[model samples]
Each structure stands twice: as C-alpha cells, then as structure tokens.
Target: MQLCAPVGCPYFRGMASVVVEFSAQEPERLARWWADVLGWHLDTRSGTVVQPTGPGVPLRFVVSARAKARKNGVHLDLRSESHDDQNTIVERLFNAGARFADIDQSSDVPWVVMADVEGNELCVLEPRKVYADTGPVAAVVIDTSDPRSDARTMATATGMELAGERSEFASLRPPSGEGPFLEFLESESGPEGMLRVLVE
Candidate 1:
C-alpha cells in the first residue's frame, strides 16, 4: 500500500488537506448535508462536496455505495484550544446534527468522540497542555474507497491548492501546515467494513 502525491488540477492551491469519505446508501444527500454544515460548496461535476480551509487542510466528503457496517474504527482526533472552546464547538456541532459518543475524558485525556450524520466517528481533542508548544498534527488517513478524488473535491471547496498525487493516494498542503494529508484507500471488504487506516 503506497501513498501517492497529489496530481495537478484546478483545485490544487494552498496547503493542509483533510479528506473524509462516507459510505452511504444515499451518497448525494449525505454529501449535500455535510456541505451545508461545513459551509462548503458542492462540485456537481465531481459528485463531491468540499469545505475550504484557511491556511489549513480542506475537508472533503466522498460517496460510497455501501452502508455503514459499524462505528468507524480509525477516526480523526481534532485538538481544541481550550475547554470553553471545546464546549462551544461541540454544542455547535450538536446543533448541526452531530451525535456524541461515549468517552471518559474526565480523568486526564482531553478529547471527545462524536459521530457525523452517517454515524462515522471523529474525535475532538483538547490541547495536551496550556500553551503547549508543538507542531500541528499531520494528515489523517481515513478508510475510504477513493481518496484521490475526495482530496480534489476538498481542494475545490476549501480554496486550498492541490499539491500532488502518487499511485493510490493524493496530497494537499495548506500554508499553516496544520492539517493532515487526507488519503483514500480501496478495500475489498467495502468502506464501512474496515476500521484500519492502513492495511499493512
């Protein structure tokens, strides 16, 4: 399983890129819902929707024919600046129709897991320490059917430039370098059946 650089196209522009693929019985509807929620525009030509990223990776949504088998095994862990910020954002997401998942954050860890409209899981994490100095987390590879296409759609919506693409993968980098390179992978068992980010 080799990852590829992004291919040059009209959508390639900025830096960070985050790609998310959804396995839905109704891909177009789900994609449209996410587009509105993320404040992104839909690229009808590509049948994908994108949310532009400011100096960060763009968010993308891909449609799959399969139904979600189970809760996503591997998902994103987004870091928030503070507790108040986390609460505020979480409320916003909930109002936007995001469902909360079970996680024990009261102990020490500073993160919460939540599911999107389709029941795909994602995490909202708090910073490790107060004003902790650290580099942004790189790309997160979610399980998907077509990562390259998804990456392109994200670039279009977010206004981020497409960097390059390799054999089975695509790369998008934002100016801040705070976002991860979203990659799509093919699976024989279908998108929703597996939780592993990488097969190997």
Candidate 2:
C-alpha cells in the first residue's frame, strides 16, 4: 500500500468514502436509534441502513448474536452548537434510551460520554470550530496503539487526506473537506472496539 507523507499528505479529490457497519442483536432498533439521533432516514425494506439527507456517512446495522462486553475503542463523536445544546442533546438521547457511560474519562472533560440502547459508546462533544462543517457527527475515533502510523495507513488506504497530527492523535478527512473526520487516538490497550468498516 502507498504510504502518506509525514505531513501535508495528498488528497484523493473525493474519490473515496467510509461506511461504518454496526453489529447489534436488534439491527432495526439500533438503526432507528441512530437514524433519529442523526436526523437520517432508516430503511429496513431489506437489511437495516441509515441514510443521511446530506453529507455524511451511511451507517449499516447488521444482526449479531454476540453481545458488547467492553468499551468500544472505535466510537462516534457528536457535534454540539454550544454548551446548552450539548446538554439538551444528551437529555434528548437519555429519553430515547441512551445512558451515560464512563470510559475512564475525567470529570472535567469537555465532552459527555454515552452509550446507546445496545451499549455502543459515543460522545457528545463541546462546540469547536474545527468540527463546524462536519454535520451531526464530528468524528469517528479509533483507539490505536500508534496513532500516527495507523492514521497514515488508514489515510492512504481510504484515499483521504491527512488532516492533522499531534503527539497522541491524528486526523483524516475526505479531499473535499466535508463530512466527519476519521481520528486515531493513541491507546495502550489492543483492538477491542466496534465491528466492520467499509470504504467505498
């Protein structure tokens, strides 16, 4: 596979996109929850699929017998307009069957951790300018042992541009710079997160 440059990686001019597939015991129910959360349309005519109205990734929910046993290393981060908006969103989700989750995060963190009805972890983050154009979902974060290397590899594989990098974090996005960012976070543990990822 072709590797990206350390910095200033080349863009693929929107030739690629990513689809996150979730495995759940009740696919339609889980898909409905995410569809409501994202203001997307849920189509269960065949298999469960959540389709976005505008720019965003399409999520697919597949039936699985396996249960979620631990924290998800790959999770989504929702964008908020402000502090009040963040709280409102969290409350709305709580009423919709979402529950607060603790993944060893400190109390002072700017984001609120939550899990869906099926124990799938996600975050509602404080407002930030960088995620202003990313629609409802800000980013799909993957916990990796080496953020830099994994981000670079994923960027190359997905034909996305390397957006930015720090000591313990890295980011990638489509060449058009629209939609949610794909982030890699440095973690000490091994891969024990969500199921499948489809690049198209």
**Top of the candidates by lDDT:** 2
| All models, RMSD in angstroms | 8.9, 5.1
Leading candidate by TM-score:
2
Candidate 2 on 38-104: residue-level lDDT in tens? 8988877657778767657778798887888888777889999999999999999999999999998
In model 2, what lDDT does residue 55 have? 57
Query: Given candidate 1, what's the lDDT at residue 1?
Result: 24
Residue 172 Cα positional deviation in candidate 1, in Å, after optimal superposition: 12
Lowest lDDT block of 10, candidate 2: 1-10
User: Candidate 1 lDDT, tens digit per residue, 75-112?
Assistant: 55554567887787678778978898763336555666
Task: Give the TM-score comparing model 2 with the true structure, all chains together.
Answer: 0.89
RMSD of 2: 5.1
The superposed Cα distance between candidate 2 and the true structure at residue 75, in angstroms, equals 0.3
